[model samples]
Target: MSVVTNDEVRRELVEFLDQRQPDVVREWSLLRTFAEQRTVDAVGGCTELLNSLRRAARDGQEQNPAAAGFDDVRPMLRASAGGGASRRLDLLSLKEPLLRLWWEHRAGTPAVTDGALALSSAVDALRMVQLEEELTAGTETISMQRQQLTELSTPVIKLWDGVLAVPLIGTLDSTRSQSATESLLEQVVVQQAKVAILDITGVPTVDTMVAQHLLKTTMAARLMGVECVLSGIRPQIAQTMVQLGIDLGDLVTKASLADALSYALQKTGLAVVSADQG
Candidate 1:
């Protein structure tokens, strides 16, 4: 795509009008001849000329998809195709000059303004197409980004083959809670995990919502035939839980990830052996 800068377009227009005076003068003479010679059929001639120009513009856009401002040419040509024979001839007269200016980006050409205008129109058309493409792509982009954010924030880990670790970090709102439930359930099925660990060492605070979310994730994992062990309760959090009357009577709780792992191994019949004794 050739980019026509504002300065370059201005200079070309100046020089074109200076040197191409005669060519333009000649086109005007032809228009006059057509108007006088066939004033009655001038409209027909103008229609034919406009049709030819329209076809040429279409062909140009097709041939060079990347050509700057190619799309705008057709609409402009259409807009100029109104009224009597003389007006139509005037419109037709613009075709050759514009095409010439486009093909040869040189100075001393009188039709520089037409060329510049066409280029501007083409740019506008291309922008519309580009905007549509971006909007379409945004949906996919948001989904992928949300997944990445989940993966980064959630401390869910897959220990070896059938064992998993999910460390909860930061605040778990309703959305995060829902996501955590979904993720744990999917991973259990996909990994066929026998044991899953829920570690909350990095959590700064705990509330009813977060507690509820954790409970949901645990239950969902169990439903998938996976055992879930909650770990990493700070002393302060434990006190807060007690004060808030939160009950984990049914849920398995461990002091840390290591303790949870040991428990999970035993539950899954994965015994820890001493290598030195062997």
Candidate 2:
């Protein structure tokens, strides 16, 4: 019997796929492994995928499969058809047809066995790429969402003609503090306000770090030509500040947002009294 090498088997498998492209595509499209029913062009995507597999089969090895093959086609795999992070299940559906090709030659010539191994390696490499893409995309989305939440949580609202207010409602972390300060300063300059209020009624706790963030925000507002009124300093929080020797250092403060708003209205020469007062 003539000895057949691994390379010969791989070449034959590649040729088989090349010759049967249409049939393979049709068969792959009908597999039940696909979980996501996408609107992708099935024929075109399957054709491109097969083309990658052929290149992979030509250059890839069963020992180390993730090195090449699909590297050049990463953009299409990441953004189109079944290659996106969201369509990983759909990508998994592709493995069924490739596995069947291996089954077809499992009991045939030794060359067929070698070809099947190469085909299996190429498919495994694509799986690795898909996992990496999904992880990267998931991390990026989380980072973007955190940034948006930080900005949206510290909304600066106009309370009066010359007054703006920032109502803080969560932990005073460094990121949120910086977001608050930047927002408050910008609005102070844009609204040309004389008074700004930092209301912390919803703040759950007070610590040295929280005190420092509050002071920094007030100082920044001062530089923008707006006086800051710290409000909603609950009794427990005030006691903690004193216990910790945290100083207000001549910064104006009030017991509640209502008191702070009253101070703001007076500073802006506006009065809100009941009609019964007259």
Candidate 3:
């Protein structure tokens, strides 16, 4: 009734051959012997299958000419892809049935024509649904890849008290730095935290441009009434920052996450729970 149903039948045929039934076992044995004994051409099986289908159609031609026409066309329709020529063939596959329905209508069988039209419409609708599912899956895969890239490139961590520790783990070229700036700002506003500690310890080096971007981000945080701290500066990085003449005097810089946490806690008017306090 449908291409899907026909595909299922093909699968069932393959499965039937695999089950090794007494009748099919003889056929399988012959095929195995043929493959073992002779130097068969690569496409011999395809050619034989096509020839057999052609002979079957020819044998049925005298019995039912219309059904033979449909059988003759089934192969071409099955071989068609969703390409231009295949689209034409798919429509042509149903054309013969529609033509028969037209003749039947003239013979006072309008119900036959109605049934054929409904089946044809149903097949076309099913094709559209399959195409839509393929497109949606492709779109979702791309979206997931983008999400994974975002997670890998940007680092986010939560610290004690209300502070969030975000470490810039690699080089912050202008594009990545911009994304980081926006993502950090959004998280800070959403969390409503008083402190955001950006630890750059994992950053191997710093350039003037990256330092400027950091300055801009820290300034933006101040405008939003949130304190932003730079932490985890190795000696080499500190030297680079100073040599590059990048002024971070307006912002607080800490030697480590612990120091940054202490500074943030003091600024936020909060104290860490010591053992005695507990």
Best by TM-score: 2
Backbone clashes in each candidate structure, one number apiece? 7, 0, 0
> Relative to the unseen true structure, what is the C-alpha lDDT of residue 31 in candidate 3, on a scale of 0 to 100?
42
Residue range with the least summed lDDT across 10 consecutive positions in model 3: 83-92
Best by lDDT: 2
Clashes of 2: 0
**Between candidates 1 and 2, which one is better according to TM-score?**
2
Tell me the tens digit of each residue's lDDT in model 2 across 73-190: 5655556433454554456567667767556634566666666666666777776776675666668778999999999999999988889999999898999999999998888778
Better of 2 and 3 by lDDT: 2
Give the alpha carbon lDDT tens digit for every residue of 1-278 in model 1: 55665555545544544455455444434565355645445444444433333333333442233444333343333333332334332333444554464446554455456455644443344434334434444555778898788767764568757889877788877777777777777788888899998888988888777788888888888788888888999899999998998877588989898888888888887867799976
Tens-digit lDDT track for model 3 on 1-278? 22334334333323322342333223322442234423343134223332332333233221232333234334333333222331322222323443343344334433334333433443344334334444555576778887677666766566755677778887777766676777777877777778889888878789888888788877877787788999998899988878888888768898998999989888878877889878
How displaced is residue 264 in candidate 3, in Å?
Answer: 0.6
Q: For candidate 2, which ten residues in a row score worst on lDDT?
A: 32-41
Q: Rank the candidates by lDDT, best first.
A: 2, 1, 3
